[model samples]
Target: MLLPIFHFSAAAIDAYVFWYDQNYVDLPFKNPMVKELPLKSRCMFLTIWCLILQIAYHTVAFLNDVFGTNAASPKKKPTIRLIKDVLFSVAFPIAMYVSGAFWGIYAVDKDLIFPEHIAKLYPVWVNHVLHTTVAIFMFIELLTTNRNYPSRKVGLSVMSVFIGAYISWYLTVYFKTGTWAYPLFDELNWPLRIMFLLFSYLLVIAIYIFAEKLNYVTGSSKVEKNLSGKHKKR
Candidate 1:
């Protein structure tokens, strides 16, 4: 019951926010993170990608709970399960990384990621919506759903590739467009930029490993209580 409600709300909220984002238009703020420099240019941020994944994950979870529930399990449609797992794998860690990195940098230097003038272009709460709530929903899914986390080697490899791809993309965009995708890059010299990208890679990889173990211990077992009322693991 709660799971269904949560999923519905999450999906609806993400969809609404995503739609609003697509529709809103703004002047170029010179801050790459700000939406609507050209308007559609905001799509390039990794944060946007994570938001898209969150929307997909929650929509599927909502459908699974509403139509695929059974006495044995509340939500376990096989196809939906596979998608849910795959999205969760990429989405959760990426969400954590984006939220963590954004706030972490915002704390240290607002100009580095989100400049002061960027605040005027968008509402404060919108910042929370983009950077905070998505991760919160992913964390809830972790607690509420039964999941099969990929083995560490596979998980780490996949995340490494995912992180590598983004690094390549931002670098490519910078070289091609003469623009840095995020403001952090503008502050760094080449050596520091290299270190920053390396740190980003390690951070996402660590997030994947930690989340897998956390899920195994507290979230992914497939057992329930018996007639004696003792909980057991399967």
Candidate 2:
């Protein structure tokens, strides 16, 4: 709970500052994207949104534990909890791996993926915040909590909708602005771009399955075993 809240708050603030500084407060001119600032197109921003959702879930759970009250409705808690699992299992890993790979190769040469000029604006810490902290916070959650993941059917359904929505959003942005949200996309032809997107989605599915395995290995014992000298509670 604390980890996510602290990490997300800092990330969100930093992102806001980055955006503010780049656009000089005239956000509309930052990119020629029509309609409005297409924030959803940025993987970092989406990861931050996922982190915020996790924070909300933890805050509710914490209050319920502390107060000994079921203030949160039954269906509401499960729905939110499932979404949190999906985000942590799917969204965070995708963001972490994508950004990490982009910057890793990018460090060797500036013109690889990002524009050479964009690299000059921010230091290395910006990359760490965007790419590294997500995995750290996600692992912390996995290690600490006995989380119950949604069934494969439910998980995949949610995953499809989530990924599909984002693809739609970025595609719309591209159509409107005549540019890809990320520079890597611009480099690929249509067929390769479609294949890349499909491959990325499949990779996320694999990561989600890996997360389920991690949950089973780490959570099962703590969930099933009873502590000595304590009530043999379920």
Candidate 3:
């Protein structure tokens, strides 16, 4: 139900953007991060990427949980945990963008107002930042605290990865399509771009700190007891 809605919205927006670009003026694909691809091709690629991300996330999570084959495993070596952590962290944000959840609202709006240039691009950017920050924070929490729920962490980690990749994709589009998604970032000034990146990094760091504090407060009661028990046994 939700998926169909997202699909319809994306198609409609893409069609509108195509019309606007051809008739209205020579708008770059940067604002909404839309390309000049045919609707069919865009949808096809979206579907393919969605399936790929879904499969990859689930496969890694299942392996980690059932076989202790990845980061979730208590007995696994640090190297395996590190590799899986990096992979899982990167997959999340990208999947979210491809799933259409990241830009669904903006895609449906199509008013060409508020966000100014590329209406859809605003939501995509916000979604990417929010989801990426949250996911990375959660992943760091899992690594530092060694929580038990691999499923939850995996879900978050995959979202983070997807978001990071989507941001990179948008940067590429900004260069190639010359359609600045955000007017603030569209200036093409190196200083502004660097500032934006720095801001994003700081936001992610703040989120990580909050997550760690929350983990300490919540997990301390349970994990501490368990650790104390093991120490006593020895």
What C-alpha lDDT do the candidate models reach, one value each? 0.72, 0.55, 0.41
In order of appearance, the predictions have TM-scores of: 0.83, 0.67, 0.39
* Candidate 1 wrongly placed segments (more than 4 Å): 27-39, 67-77, 219-234
Winning candidate number (TM-score): 1
Superposed Cα deviation of residue 72, candidate 1 (Å): 9.7
The deviation in Å at residue 76 for candidate 3 is 4.0
Q: How far is candidate 3 from the true structure (C-alpha RMSD, Å)?
A: 11.6
Please state every model's RMSD to the true fold in angstroms.
Answer: 4.6, 5.7, 11.6
Cα lDDT for residue 115, candidate 2: 62
Model 1 global lDDT (CA atoms, 0 to 1): 0.72
Report how far residue 137 has shifted in candidate 2, in Å: 0.7
Q: Which ten residues in a row have the lowest lDDT in candidate 2?
A: 223-232
Clashing residue pairs in all predictions, respectively, total 1, 0, 17
lDDT of 1 by residue, 55-170 (tens): 88888877766655312233434676666666678889999999999999888988888876666666666678889998888886776567665566776776777777877877
lDDT sort, best first = 1, 2, 3
Return the clash pairs for model 1, or none. 36-39
